[model samples]
Target: MSRIGKRPVDLPSGVEAKVSGQTVEVKGPKGTRSFTATDDVTLTVDDGKVSVTPRGSSKRAKQQWGMSRTQIANLVTGVSAGFKKELEINGVGYRAQMQGNTLKLNLGYSHEVNFDVPQGVTVTCPKQTEIVVEGADQQLVGQVAANIREWRKPEPYKGKGIKYKDEYIFRKEGKKK
Candidate 1:
């Protein structure tokens, strides 16, 4: 009954998927990733595609059906093409630089904010104001970008802070003179 669950995730060329118990592992040229589905849903990889079906007609089963399918799809996409997120700093003195495994941030704060890059995720600063997060895990890449953005979220008035490349901050009018 789940729309997303009904569609099978097709494996791209040169990508391989293996099913072991409730877990599905995908391997590709970029990297390898795995996902474990809840018991409420059954996972299967056949031919060149993966499918998910609910074990019963319960709410939890249906919930897991779609979620499990998406997770599996993300695993495939992640291993194949990987994932990336970009952030931009928009303040006068705000900037970011990478020091080996650490990301040094100057977000107009009293002291510089040093963000330690976690395993499985690569943080790079192509420009002083641009940050790029890359990884095979979609969640980790997104979470790393979010954590960096949290240091200095864009303000509504001047919109001076860090934000995603495609994000738009709503501006508010200044106080009356």
Candidate 2:
């Protein structure tokens, strides 16, 4: 049995969800997000909650059961409270700032890298070493943060690069004399 699949996703007060065939759409104060699941699972909405069930007892159906349920739950949480990802710069010359709809990053490179912020997502820099990405869609917010971090990934030795707020850098021993 699928433990997670059995639990229905409860809709918040201001959030609403609609299940049509294999597609689920959720609307809230932040924005509207939708997902289309595979045929292996069935989506149902009732009594201010949404549920997912497998169409059959096959292996694929069972695999999708729990996955579909979590997807629906993400949709609910995303629309209601939205999502965010924070990045921290750890290098001396590395810094970030916002310019209109663009993000200016100085990650020890000879030239400052300009990152264009996409629509539906908001990128902000409260400080030179901090970057915050916020949006209704969790995937888009995470992707934007990843793209920004790609310019200067954190290194294991000096750890001078961009990294997540809660991420830990595993230190390695230097060369022996």
Candidate 3:
């Protein structure tokens, strides 16, 4: 049995889960999310708890089953407590700001990059160099953060670019004159 799959997921208060067919819908204070279990995986909700089991004994099936369960659990937690990602600008002229529903970023480019913020997610710049992204969907939040980071990944030579607030990028020394 899979250790993570064997553990039951505890549903928090104010969060409601409904299992209909192969799709599981989770509703909470933040928002609602739904996920479908694979054919080799089965999920059930009982008394505010969720359980996942494999439909077959094959190794691949078991792996899918465990992954399905983890995805469902993350969805439940995300809707209940939400998710957050913090980013920091390292370049000299790099900065970010919120304008209406869009996030405009200046990453030393000739023109600014404007990213549209999707519904159910919020992006804020607490400080000039700090950015915070929050949402009820874990996947969406993470994807957005990744997209932002992709604009200007940290360079190994100078460690200058956009990166996660807690992320560390190793720097290499420049050539001697």
| Model 2 misplacement above 4 A | none
TM-score of predicted model 2? 0.96
Compare candidates 1 and 3 on lDDT and give the better one.
1
lDDT of candidate 3 at residue 118, scale 0 to 100: 87
For model 3, give the 10-residue run with minimal summed lDDT.
Answer: 60-69
**TM-score of every candidate:** 0.95, 0.96, 0.94
Please give the range of 10 consecutive residues that has the lowest summed lDDT in model 2. 70-79
Model 2 C-alpha lDDT per residue in residues 29-104, reported as the tens digit of each score: 9889899999999999999999998998999999999998998888888889989999999988788999999999
lDDT of each: 0.92, 0.92, 0.90
The CA root-mean-square deviation of candidate 3, after full C-alpha superposition on the true structure, stands at: 1.3
lDDT value for model 3? 0.90
Task: Give the per-residue lDDT of model 1 (tens digit) for 1-177.
Answer: 999999999999989999999989899987888888889988888889999999999999999999999998888888888899999999899999999899999998899999999999989899999999998899899999999999999999999999999999999999998
Candidate 1 segments whose C-alpha is farther than 4 A from its true place: none
After superposing candidate 3 on the true structure, give the runs of residues whose Cα lies further than 4 Å from its correct spot: none
**Comparing 1 and 2 on lDDT, the stronger one:** 1
Whole-model lDDT for model 2 versus the true structure? 0.92
